[model samples]
Target: AIRCTPPDALRALTRRQVDTAELYYIRGDVEKACELAAAAWPEPAGAEPPVRRRALALYTHTLLYTQGPAAAQKLVDDTLAQAADDPWLRSLALAFAADFNSAGDRPYARRIAVEAIKICDELGDRADPIAAAVAPMALAEIDMFGGRGLDRSLIERARAAQSGQSWIPFIDRAEVHLGLSAKHVDDLGTSQAILTRTLRQAQDVGESSAMLILQAHLAYTELLSGRPEAARAALAAFDAAAREAGPGIGEPGSLTVSRALLAIMDDDLDRAEAILLAALERLPPIPIVRVVMDTPLGAIALLRGDVERAITLLAGVLEQARAVHVNEPSVRGRPEGDLGQALVTAGRLTEAAGVADELAEIGARLERPTLTGIALRVRGLIATARGELDEAEKLLGAAAQAHAASPMPVERGRSLLALGQVQRRRKAKTEARRTLQEALDCFTAHGHRPLARLAEAELARGQRAGAGSVLTASEQRVADLVADGFTNREVAARLSMSVRTVESHVASVFRKLQVRSRTELAARFKQ
Candidate 1:
């Protein structure tokens, strides 16, 4: 019976082996599988028809998993060259290529993914769920790069096709869920649940590497949920899993960088600095989310009053961010947003406002409320500095609403603080008090110690009206600038008026308020 085994049975054995290898490769056991597949490849000269082709495909994935995209590219190209007319080979080849391209320098990944998706769809019952998963991921990745709204149509297509599919589809589903959650941070519960399920499935199938990745995602989500301790625990779990699985288990540099951020959040500046420095030194030059990593590090440096380090890191990050195609989706518009914040802190309000404008436009297109709120807040601060109270009020109010819509408690609390400041300047003392108190409560609840402290300080100052109801046009201009918190020069340039005109307004406002300087005017409003 063994000697007389049917060709069909032999072919089935080969297919099962191929599938097994794929499972191992995806789970991060690339080195072991690749070596075994390489030796076992070149199937018996006259073996069943599908055996050789299946082995080639399996070997391609093994190479990809072990050596990354470049090696995978060669295997796909070679396979396509050999079997130019085979629909199965073509579909597999193109799908792998598209997956590689999706991570490449250009945006060609989406196009290739779509073509493969079409081929698979036309192939009907034989369609590969893996290809289907790649298609939408590529498309969504493209949409993210442009800072544009994601194509729900494509995402829905992937979701519909993933029903009862294999591990590949589930992995893809996890990615899609993460993308959506990133866009809508308020949907943390849904996102976390999706990741949890995906991780379980991956673990059940021995896809340890994928499980680790999903675990990291869950950790980050915990960070967003304001559970730093839980986030740390998750990261530690990932670290242990990674060590057990060995290398080839996806990137860990970013995870290490994330740990630094947690340390910073905990107010452990020494630990944060030590971790960041170590990770930065060990990480490869080709980093994933480089700008995002650099921006947070810069923020920490700035917080520690390491202005030189902040400038170096922030400026370097911004340059790289701008150098990119300006359309990659992973970091969203965070690079520009970070730069704007850095510029504002460095007293470059004009540059900050410009960047904020760009970020706002991008965020609007993406329908990401948190980013929009950030952009608006930056602009509002600029306006306040320019003495544009009316404009400041409008921008601040919009920012507050956007923050309220965001799922991030910390962001919401910060927005409340900024809005309260604007209201206080408007002489709406009751409203300001209410808003400020709400901010204090939110920050306190969220463990945002610094913001809560600031809110408390603002609330402790009794309210006072520095400017009267009936003011001259010049005084009105000054009031606007004062409320917006703009510099004299910025106000003049924005209004198309002279610096002397702005100064004259400020002088007149000082006389009316009987205040010595702008600082006194601001203090009076707060009091």
Candidate 2:
């Protein structure tokens, strides 16, 4: 109909094309939507202000997913230049800029979002409704991405502006931001409830895109709240829904991170590695996505007993996260703690000490018990490595106590395990057994198989004789070789013994050292 219309009548038909493009976007046909939106106003400078604004909004949004952020950013820049005198169009352009920048340049995003809101405020009753609604939402999104506590005033303003707009996408986005803000504050219960409820609303309205993103958010919240089974279920549901919806409907980075975390919990390190590596190839160069994905890869390296590799991976992630000012406890905290552990394992105590201090400062600044607990645990590990058993015991105990204030079962279990090891080293047999049992119960209930196995080994060690009394010189040699990544056959060859004899010695060393696997053996050797 547009092409058949007279050239002079084309202006009247443009709104129809923009509306159709929006419908396409809502229906998940993003490429088609981009095509239509782009066709509607090929030259923004020549089109009417209102038509150009609508075309730019739809085109840039669709372009973001189809052609990447750079293309969308270019369009937004052009629109901003063209709309300098038009407060409404300028505010919308700023809002778009703020939303995309939240993924990368968070501080800048926050600044511009505030500026957009100021423009709307000055315009007052004359401000465009969409611009008014989106400006505050963009600021709230930047706050969410930065892991700063959400400003309820901004959220309320966005919600109020959205009233009577009938813009389903922005409405759903506001709700998601609210849900994730609860998560940022570690209010997992509220986050889960809001996300679940919002997801149902989206589903009821056939909002497929919102539903997929909400599923990812809910799964991440479940994982953090120590409900791995529920997290797994949510992820499975997301995958099934995405498959049915074809493609371009889900948030790839978030879904990838969540799935990789689940795999890590299940001890499927290879699967997690593959998932993250694949995502690295295809995922955009967004700072937050890179940080989240690489942190888990560092964890996988750490789990494999590659101390140097883990240190290198985690250190890079920590540096990038700091560069972006990623103060979120989960994003920066996890990698920082892991890097400290890796440094300690690699015998870099000074660097590990610096990491511990940084964590403590971050914890105090954020007022998050979880970060405080992690800092204590890292400090305790450093103390243990330095052979200060009393300090290790004290720190680990405090770490466990700090974690008890939060609902982080995995972190609490880790502190208990570390404390039990310190107690055993101090020859507090009864206390060590009790602590180990508690750690075991926590890991078992959370289905953390890897950590549960470590706790079980610690318990078994408490039941046996001391390491010095049980292991002979030959067994010690075999143990040292195995912990150094030498196979039993290689150890036997190096020691001029039979493979069977080496195997027997290895078993004795494992029993005496109270370790269940080579990774544990390596950790014991490092300590």
Candidate 3:
């Protein structure tokens, strides 16, 4: 379906029935698409390079969705053997085949995609859209996996060939839609619409495997939109469809992971945890599984007040995610947010602030509203811990607004609670009380008892009976400066206080904050 002539236009040519079939296939008509392809060159025994490669591409794609990676790999290997001179086909086969594997294998997929891109770049725009599509799909996956470097140009160029409309472009476009939806929770409606349309088109064409994959994503998007019931329904539909399609319809680890995620959303923590552990047992080693599973597990644990356990798991997963470059635009920024919470629990305020900054950057780049809100909430916590009450209040308020705009239930609840805590600390008693009550309502609505209890505590804090306020304004200011990597002399010079006075303030701030060492003080700032 590369940027070639339309099927009808190509039908006018005497020996291009295969081309016409390819056109139909690219447009989402897999059966008719395959038929056209078969009719174009009745036999591959004595076919030329174009017909052989075309047939191999069609058959390979068919096997991928219907059989499994092994079958598809055989076809790909045979095609490569036959088309040894063609780097383009080889690249496509390599990348497309890797899609059936884990995210740990993403680097392999990315490599193939890059190879395709390199070939295309060398060939110039004269290259067909068929070859062009592979590069962008690869880049998108790479960006989604790595959490950085989304090449919009590659995506746009790959889709430039409407005349050669085929299932590949549609599949690639659907992938983009899912990726964008996962990354950006701000506009759930638009993203969901795109996924819906893509799934429909894939189904209409007998692309059952593609349809199943899209269905999983659709369910994920629904869950992200704060509709766990809808997500459950969608997952059921996907499971049913996959089962009807028989074995090999769904990839090995994919459906399993989706089910686990759904379980987490349902608050079936035991089931969710078991599912993840089982997945780890069966699936190939991959950073995505660890990162994805740990984030939710940590969230669930945190909600359950298993703070120390949550911190340990999340911190470990965050390191794994970073090791594998999992912060990409398509994967969502949940890992960083999860890690920030872990840091907060451990009272590593400065570290948590850095993680929050990372989350903010990820959200902005990916257009993710929910993630941005969570990052803002964490920033508010960091600010409050550092005694910047006004800034903390402002950030917390922004978090509330951002959460309100998205459909992520957990994030919304957390934002509300964090905002309430900041407001209470700022001495806005009535507002704090109201906000904490609202947060409690949200947590209760979601059936999150632990979070509801925490919110209640914040509400009580708004009317606290503390015997003393330990850190004075000057001391807090000096603490903030020191935590920001400023020396005592620098803090004194900037604040117009003597070095000795600055040191005295720092010591008092440390005692009042119940921390020891500059590292601990820095950690508080991050929280």
Candidate 4:
């Protein structure tokens, strides 16, 4: 119909093309939608402003999903240059800011978002409803990536405004933000409920882009809520959708992190590291992504007993996180705790103590249970290193209590592990067994294999500490050889025992002796 129209009637025909493109977009035919939207654009200079603006907005938005943010950059820049004061153009600017954000140009994104908000304020009653709704949402998103706490009121206001407009897609966008905010505040249940319901709505309308984004968010929320199986299913669905949508539909940062975490849960450190490294290469230098990815990488190093590498990775992550102003527990606090643990493992007690102090201060100031619990766990580890067994026990027990009200079972399990170890050191055999059992149960239930192994090792030590002696006869023989500087394999050869049994006995001996290293064990034996 458009091609058959007379040359003089092309302007109206172009507008009709944009309307048809919007219908295509609504029906999830994104490639067809984008082609039509792009064709409707570059309208004649004398064309209707509303028609041009609508075409530009649809074209840029659809292009983001079809060809990524870079493809839309020129159009957004050229449109804004000509109509900086246009309300619909201002709204388009807000949407473009969000694209820049996802592309990792946070400062530029923030500037555009703030300017759009100011323009919306000036337009007041005359402002486009979409612009009015998106301006605050865009700014809030930037702030969140900057490590600033989410301004949930902005999301609420956007939702209220969008609701009045009766635009289902716009309302779904607001709900996505709200769901993410809930996740940030540790409200896992609320986050899951909102994302799940909104995702269903998006699917119902064939809102393909919205559905993909929501699925990514839901995957991460499920991971955080200790539902790795659910997270895996959601992420798989997201990947399937993106594949069907074609090559240019890229994975979101949240989905990348979720995949890495699932790998970590499966005890596949190599796979997790590979996932994170790939993300760093392909994704923009988004600070939150860096923090999240590197922290886990550091933890994998620590799990592998590469103390120096863990410290290096974790220290850099913490420094990057500190540059951001907000004290978001998951971003800053988790890295702090990880770095502290690495420092302690390296026998850098003084530096570990300093990290503990800073973490405790942040936890106290924020009054968040997760942060407080992490701080206490770190402090407890430091105390154990210093051989303050009773203090370590108290701190770790308190840390477990702090995490009890929180949804993160993994953290609570960590506290219990520390408490159990401290109890073993203090000769509280029954208590140690009970605490270690609970820690093992928590880790096993949550599918945290690496942590569960640590609990198992602790339980093994507790069993050897049965009856009167802290070590069994076999463990005593292993400790004697270890104190004489014999390696596990060497000791196993001498004792005619398997290397695995020798290793287990060696670990039990170290815990029973309250020593951090072989040298410390040698000294204790000499005394």
Candidate 5:
């Protein structure tokens, strides 16, 4: 007769601890699983090397999900060292290695992940399909951040692996991960539906640990949908779940990060900054977590008009973002656009032009017209600044069409204003006058008063142009300063006008003289 033994006693006779830990994990009994996994060590150390390797792989895997990659960093190397001949174990080791490196060194992290996938591909269906299935999830994690295309087939394969299995291995994580991916890809409905289902399942199983993760995700989804109160409610649930479950995967720190994001959306930059800084201090440097916290912090610096600080924050963020480009491809556009615009705001148009060129390439590759249009608009503005009117006109006209398709009125208006500025610079006063007027109207309709005021100034410049037209006394003074070889900055200081206003006046002076640059205006008047 078979004797019924406790799980730990059964562990001595078989690989039961590791096996049961796997069940506990899949069922979302996270703390219980982790404890059992940690005990799987000491190990069935008396077991054959392969069994020991499997135990180590399972233990490290549990740590990775629960405590973040940094928490598992040391174990990755130890597991691989001991499991050298087992391709499945080594592949798992490599995946955790990638996750660990994701925080600070992206390129290195990707190399490790590629090697892991390679091993899995070679071992596909031969060693362990369960292990093979995880490779794609690893790739998806990397690809999602880089704005690279995330092949849904990878996710589909992961989901398929759980079928016909009574235990529903890997915690049915594919659904939740896919839900997270949807959030990245701007498919909020799919995300919500999938996550809500996962949440219900976790609830049915009484897996409060998984509930914390699912709730945090739900909060993020609500935040993206612009339902802040719903997001807050979800976060509150996540916090409550964490309190109950003892900080499972994506807990405590993820809660803090979510709160910071909500504060940012509410325009409470100070609170966002404080929360982010504290989280960064306390949390493990997981790549996804780091980027989530930093992106908004940088944006806040930009919004505060701390141009240098914004550049410092955003430029570093963008650099790391590119290096780790495969993490979340769907969520990359806004940060890229923000950095480019911050450069423009700082009057770093030359640098902004380079950034715009890269963004345009990325946008085109992604086939995302909105990002493409924004990139084109930035390029057009840069060309206008450089006196490249023909190129500016082409870029801005294309941008306007793209933004109209996007239905983003403010962006379209900005493009129109840029096109008008180009026309004004090219001395096409009739076209410039009409175009500038249209831009003013667009900006006014959008409640973007500052840009509207800029558009108005452009219109005033067009109206004050020509020998036959009556000049505003202010226009007359700006025109004389430009004709006397003063740069827009100098004219701005002399006339108490903003530099942008001075640019408009100077463009008017050029149109009135039928000249191009300030040099041309100086030459014409001197001659």
Candidate 6:
């Protein structure tokens, strides 16, 4: 067995270690990758250079992704100094450099990524195929989308470069494969099909440790894609797997998110808010969680009609999204779409138009049907608020048409109600009645009685205004609350509504009773 060694004998240990590090990296186990790779560096005098360079590269990559740029910068600077002549090592370090500045300097990240790609190209097809694959894979995530987000060609290149390469293992390929799959992960049918395959593949290969996290991801995907039953089942499976693996296992952060989404589905905002805030505190505010959880916390505020607070919450999430290179659409879509809605509700029409323009830019870049519909709906609201009836009708018509195809009924129902409001405002009584009736039908079909009543009141000459006796049930409650001298935020808390919506209801109370101040309303109620 010790008769003779191969020409690449010196590469044996470091090469195998790099392969194992890639496995940990793919599993989201950054610490393990760092641990394995940190020991492979400081290459011995006569060792093959690629093995030593790869270990240094992986150590930097893992450290950057997990601990962030500040923590890894010194190590990267030191290693690159030693391996300055190595094209493969330099390409990886530059890509990690792009990621390092991703939050602080996006323009710089693009510049660095371009340089990294050129270095990889210099290595060519015959030399350092793994770097050839990884440079583009890393670059694809950081490059400017020309407002179109990631280019398909770059993703294909990353996938293609990995072909016929023995340096990267099959297990390490899962992350790359799943990165592509996460695009369709917001749709039920497609998500389930793709996730099932991913889960099965992990299982077939006995990679159960990776499956623990994958199961939670599939569950979260199910929660978003409109399959609560399937989500519930996936969660159960995840719990079982997590328990079987013992304590401190899998990513429970996504589980917390799934629970919050479930609460949202049940119309339990109070519960959803509590869970979201708790998780936001407990988990690191990573890009994926910000997209999935933090944005929803703002949605809860918006649901309560707390438009100002919603804006504050969503603005922070959007800021992070712009800084980080999270190419997932769902991650970016929520804050952009809902921030516009919040502005519209706060009667900030000009600002709402700005938000709408931002969303339209996203829609143009992403070309997603749901986001495009929301942009249209928000634009229609801006038009309607400005009394541009004809333009509002055109925009609203397109919005309704787009929403009609959405998996989420709330979207379609919202567009219908908005259209009805425009019709009523235009004094198109017959059209208003039909449109409002359709809106009512939609809400009722979805078992949304409270929303249906809002539509019914719209059809009744806006009876929520002008007289206490004529006040709709909601308006009556708002009137009593106003009489009690409660502030908008307090009343919102009491009624599980937003402060802005409460302000609107209070304004209606003042109009109906012809009262100017809270004191006046309170005295009238005293009678």
| Candidate topping lDDT | 2
Candidate 6 collision pairs:
304-497, 304-498, 305-498, 305-499, 306-498, 466-512
Q: Please provide, for model 5 over 388-454, each residue's C-alpha lDDT reduced to its tens digit, 9 standing for 90 to 100.
A: 7799899988988887765345567767777876776676878878877888887665445545656
Which stretches of candidate 4 lie above 4 Å from their native place? 1-7, 23-35, 44-51, 63-76, 84-88, 91-95, 102-112, 166-172, 243-248, 278-289, 321-333, 353-366, 465-527
Local accuracy by lDDT, each model: 0.65, 0.77, 0.63, 0.74, 0.66, 0.66
Model 2 TM: 0.85
For candidate 5, report its TM-score. Answer: 0.68
How many angstroms is residue 149 displaced in model 3 relative to the true structure, after the best TM-score fit?
5.8
Cα error, candidate 6, residue 286 (Å): 6.6
Q: What is candidate 1's local distance difference test score? A: 0.65
- lDDT score for residue 182 of model 2: 72
Residue 452 lDDT in model 1? 68
Evaluate model 4: give its TM-score.
Answer: 0.81
Over 4 Å off, model 6 = 1-33, 44-47, 61-68, 96-105, 144-146, 166-193, 246-256, 285-293, 323-329, 387-390, 404-410, 423-527
TM-score of each: 0.75, 0.85, 0.68, 0.81, 0.68, 0.75
Tens digit of per-residue lDDT, candidate 4, span 1-527: 66776767777778778878877776667788899988888764635766776676678778876776677787777776877556667566666655456436667777777777677677777666666677678777767655565788888777766776634353236777778667776678888998899888777777777778789989988887778889999998998888776644468777888888889899898999999899999876756568777887887777665667878998888777656533465643277767777777666778887877876775666556777888888888888767778888899999999999888788898889878867876778899899999999998988889788667755764443222267765777577667667676545533434557778887888777678898988777665
True-structure RMSD, every candidate: 7.3, 6.0, 11.2, 6.5, 8.7, 6.2
User: Model 1: residues >4 Å from true position, as ranges?
Assistant: 1-16, 26-28, 39-58, 121-126, 159-170, 173-187, 203-206, 243-254, 305-319, 326-333, 422-433, 456-527
What C-alpha lDDT, on a 0 to 100 scale, does residue 174 get in candidate 6?
28
Q: For model 2, what is the error of residue 130's alpha carbon versus the real structure, in angstroms, after optimal superposition?
A: 2.7
Model 2, which residues run further than 4 Å from truth? 1-12, 42-52, 143-147, 170-172, 466-527
Shift in Å, residue 409, candidate 4: 1.3
